[model samples]
Target: MNNNNALLIIDMQQEDGFVLEHFDSTVNNIAALLDTARQQRVPVIYTRHINQADGSDMPRGEPRAADGGPSSYRAGTRQVEILERLAPRADELIVDKGRYSAFHRTDLDARLKALRVETLIVSGVLTDVCVLSSVLDAFALGYHVRLVSDACTTTTLAGHYSSLLIMANWVYALEILTCAQCLHALCDRAYVSLAPQQPDQFAHQPHELENTIARLHSHLVRTQE
Candidate 1:
């Protein structure tokens, strides 16, 4: 809602490594967020997971093509491009990275600093990988984050919710929200969010994952405005 907030969309490329859960709905959700952000003049930043065209910058152990190029998101390829529907406008920021976290070896932090951004509203793909790592790094960089839980997905629903719970438990300055709630917040309206009141609030055993995630979701909607 404040000018200090930014919409950080991470790795929403055309890469097809995994058939992500709820990918279509997630894209629609993010598109809605983007539209609203543009309407409100909120700064929108995007991260692309670009690897070297020749695999020179590929991280150790990353898969490679027969020509020794990075298997995915290789530079100059269509797959590394952001989804056409979610493409950035000229004024929007785009951060390209070779690593999972957008902040890793990138100028994202410095750019956010120049913009005077204090909070990040995060969305995008691979909930257990890039999204997870980026959210954690955002927290570490002292940026308060609002995670749009359903606007990002992983290969499985389990991985999606598990990563969310991990952030809820330890990312102390986080507020786990849905796409609707985030929109409400952006518009300066009353909205319900599942921010942790204490550390380890969503702590649960492996087998209790679903129950824990359900409990978290219940809190988000129970007090809806």
Candidate 2:
């Protein structure tokens, strides 16, 4: 795994009205990715969407209930907390925002730069909303993005699939893969853990080892170039 890669888990919170399809499977896949990231010593970043207690930070002209009550994700409320199953470690970065994109009015870009994160492994809820927004912004900022298909879901299957297709085809050259594929790619790059026992056998063709490493790294990052 590249040392400059980071895992971004966006808005996996406990909001009441935000029901995702295949919630259990998505969470499990996210958890697996989280474990792999930690094992590879990659930075893990989490994003939470929270608004003001009085709904002052909510988007203006948003639709309201028949009673004219505003719908908001209040800060410090249980609804805004990250889901317990994929809780971030104390050492991980947790960025709170009031907008759909994690970079909007937030320090996510700076934080990722500080960690020297050249690639972002993205997974989270609402594939067509926050995930799509964040991925677009990340691409704009020149970060190679990998979207874990099984680790993300939306309220509707159509939304999820449509968003993935748009991202893969038009918005960006995103490397979309399953949790197992991602894990295997990460493990393959960890040379210390997966090194061959017979080092002397391949010493005559050192270029072969170099080429293998380069190919695997390229496969993982999937740069547009």
The candidate maximizing lDDT is 1
What residue runs in model 2 are displaced by over 4 Å at the alpha carbon? Answer: 63-72, 189-225
By summed lDDT, which 10 consecutive residues of candidate 1 come out lowest? 216-225
Q: How well is each residue in 65-125 modelled by candidate 2, as lDDT tens digits?
A: 4545446466667988998988888999999998899899999999998888888989997
lDDT of each: 0.90, 0.77
Candidate 1 per-residue lDDT, tens place, 80-178, comes to: 889999999998889999999999999999999998999899999889999999999999999999999989999988788888888988999999888
Best by TM-score: 1
TM per prediction: 0.96, 0.79
What alpha-carbon RMSD in Å does predicted model 1 have with respect to the real structure?
A: 1.4
